[model samples]
Target chain A: MGKKVLIIDDSSTMRKIVTRSLRQAGLDFDTILEAGDGQEALQLLAKESVDIILSDINMPNMDGIEFLRQKSANAAIKSIPVVMITTEAGADILAEAKSLGAKGSIKKPFTPEQVSEVLGGLM
Target chain B: MSWETHIADATVEIFSTMLMMEVSSQPPLTERIKSHQDSVTGMVGMAGLYKGMLAIHAPSQVAMTITGNFLGLEVDSVNDDVKDAMGELANMLAGSIKAKLSDNSKDIQLSIPSAVCGDSYSLDYQPQQGSSMVPFESAGGRFLVELQLEQQT
Candidate 1:
């Protein structure tokens, strides 16, 4: 089966960087998707399916926490895995994300090896 | 141990690890620079236990160069990519400083990143408790990371 990944981030630069990092990490997917925020990601997920999600914790409009909340409520997309890519290293928020179903998190200014080490097991 | 060192270390780490560029930090600025010419500024605010702002100011050429390095492309103008790249850099720097400020992540809250750039501009802020600006030299050029903070009583 072909794998698809959706990246949610307000910064277009960061999205591009993640796409490049996934490539650098050698985590190749059949299709790569993007969204500006959780709202956009949810909307996209409603019509399409992705194997996994990589989202930023801080974003305008809808944030990753709310996205996780809403996704967990929806049975259709609740099972898909999510990983946070953020600069927020606060244990409280990351713990919240874990409780909400975030598989893992990668901080900003992360290296390719770090990304791979986290996502390798999940992928 | 100072805010200057924190800002300097964060900036250098971001550039070296994320942007794949080696940057060197210079001595702390003795005076604040309010005006900028052909430059871009990326800023994020912190509220709650700590209240202040983190800003990164870079010349237009240097900003474009940094943006290029960020996205692995050649950038020639101060476009949206440059602004977003700069804002993300500010976000990362603020996050690092926030970690040093307190163990509880919820103690401080960071605002969404913002960017401002043009031919000429000036940013004015009234410092309450502590303020520091650190300069750095990258392959592109020199840039400064400025932080203003006041701990709530």
Candidate 2:
């Protein structure tokens, strides 16, 4: 079976774009699930098993950093690598996310090749 | 590159790469308003190091075209899809410009994007000491990107 992936972003349009980009990048995934924010993603994780996560940093509730903090503390879901796709241009934020155990990050206006390159090793 | 150049470049790249539309910068307009009667505006605010607002404004028709191209579907009018697409564009543009600003952008915090649509409306960045409005033309339509920064205390 192909790996399962979870995509989290508040914007449905962005979620669709990320999904399409992932497919275009030729990532083999059997199923792709989506959530609007980190809080919702946590709820989804409670029931589903996903190999990797693609998330956005700025969201209405439970931003990516806090979500990562919570995820890191949980033994069950801590190992699932998360790749942040966000428009946050702060190097400090990026460093903070990396310190929190994010596998990688792809900035906005990114290409499919960039997405594939970032997630290839992790996934 | 200067902030104006960055905004122009990012706008073109986003439209070209994401929406598959070709866009070129137009001369700066004295009046910030560049949209037609019916238009949509996407706005995002930045805080911390560089406090300001970034906005994208497009006529309803242009918005529909962008929405359609982004979603890979034919959109006949302005709807949730168009608003969402515009908001996403604003977010991406702010982020792209933030990156180009180098270390000065390290502490900047971006607000969630907000959008508005109407036949006639006005936005004032009052109390803002510095601002830049850049216009671009795609095909036959014109849209704008404006950056307003708060005056340093």
DockQ for the candidates, in order: 0.89, 0.70
Docking class of 1: high
Error of 2 at A113 (Å): 1.0
Clash pairs for candidate 1: none
DockQ of 1: 0.89
Q: Give TM-scores of chain A for all candidates.
A: 0.98, 0.97
Give one digit per residue, the lDDT tens place, for model 2 in B41-110: 9889988766888999999998888888888889997888889999999999988876765565446778
What are the interface RMSDs of all the models?
0.8, 1.9
- For candidate 1, the per-residue lDDT at B95 reads 94
Show where candidate 2 strays beyond 4 Å. Answer: B34-36, B102-106
Give residue B25's error in model 1 in angstroms.
0.6
Instruction: Assess candidate 2 and give its TM-score to the true structure.
Output: 0.94
For residue A58, model 1's alpha carbon misses the true position, in angstroms, by 0.5
Number of the top candidate by lDDT? Answer: 1
